[model samples]
Target: MPIYSSDSDNETMPRTKLFGRQRPIRSVLGGGQVADVLLWENKGVSAALSIGMTILWFLFEVAEYSFVTLFCHISITAMLVVFIWCTSAEIFNWTPPEMPTSILDKSTFHEFASTFHERFNQALSSFVDIACGKQPALFFAAIFCLYILSVIGNYFTFLNILYLCFVCLQTLPFLYNKYEDKVERYAGELTREVKKMFRRMNSNVLSKIPRGPVKEKKAR
Candidate 1:
């Protein structure tokens, strides 16, 4: 009797080939490729539109009316708040649970508490740096200065423009710096926390598994 090798045994085994000497099926729909192309096109269009809008807003400011300027400022503030909230939500989703529990059993408070450490700290740090960094001795001094300047300049419509310019100048640097630094730091911390939690949970599960010769045999 001849010894059979694994490869020869496999070849000789009674089995039906799935597609016997036939050309592989070609994709008919091209769904994924089509979707990717569409997404790229959409992103390009969105970027173009954003650039156009920024230019238009600048032009609008130059030819500004008091009411329109105030409206734009309020709108920008609302947009910033919404943006921050959405970012915080994304961070929350990325973070892992410190304690193990079924998804269905999770409470809103527990979720918030677990996620708040990183997101809230980043937000607070950014807000403080932007609003309180320049004149730390008197917090909100920028706001106070703007208010005084607005009054001193006699509520002049053109002064609104000047005030807006000054506010942007003072705040933009802090915003850019904090946004670059703090948000990334918080994201890093959240990612590290998630990895640590997963490791701990894995260790806990592995520890609970029985260990010994019988256990090893059973595993096999």
Candidate 2:
């Protein structure tokens, strides 16, 4: 994109994000491990997570196993393996699995907790407005949101939809970030063409429709 801006100074500008975004993608994604996995910065961890999700999907969707049952079986197997390893390590002098000193970093935990708190506070504010009848717009907006969710729920199970969204998050942003200029150019062209077509349609078809009320039956 930088090279494109240099080559076609009039056509494209430098330092522009997709959709004219203001913030960097990393900052928008909380600048964390999640962003790394999505952006393919840590390919090994990303691949492992992708493979794990695939296996889980196969187990739940193809094997028709309930989540609770599958989770319990997995937990039992992991515990058994770890217990055996720990027990046999003393006799065989095999190395034991190393434990992390901190499972979740303090910053990450605080950020996660604060996000929940903010969301709850926002929800409460909306609810209060609704209860006091202060903002009818909020009430209608809540209904619209519920209607949209219900429509989506008709087509997809919760897990299925969640998995599809996650897959998109993994692939779409990476591709867009990669081919930003081409995507933006094409998208802009398509938008202009669509608007042109709509205008043509309006002039040719919509204009011909009768607008005024019909004359009163020729004074019958």
Best-matching candidate per lDDT? 2
Alpha carbon lDDT of each predicted model: 0.51, 0.75
> Per-residue lDDT for 1-220 in model 1, tens only?
3232344444454532222313211111122322222233345643554465455555556655456766788799988986777777688885432443554334544544545565577768866776756557456766787689778677455644654564553344335333644654555556556656666666677657896755445564
lDDT of 2 by residue, 1-220 (tens): 1111123443353444555678877666556676787788889878887889888888887798998999899999999998998889878998977867996589867875775576688779878888677878677888788899899999888888778877897888678767877887777666556656776777777877889876777664
- How close is every model to the real structure, measured as TM-score? 0.19, 0.65
Worst 10 residues of 2 by lDDT: 1-10
Off by over 4 Å in 2: 1-20, 112-156, 208-210, 213-220
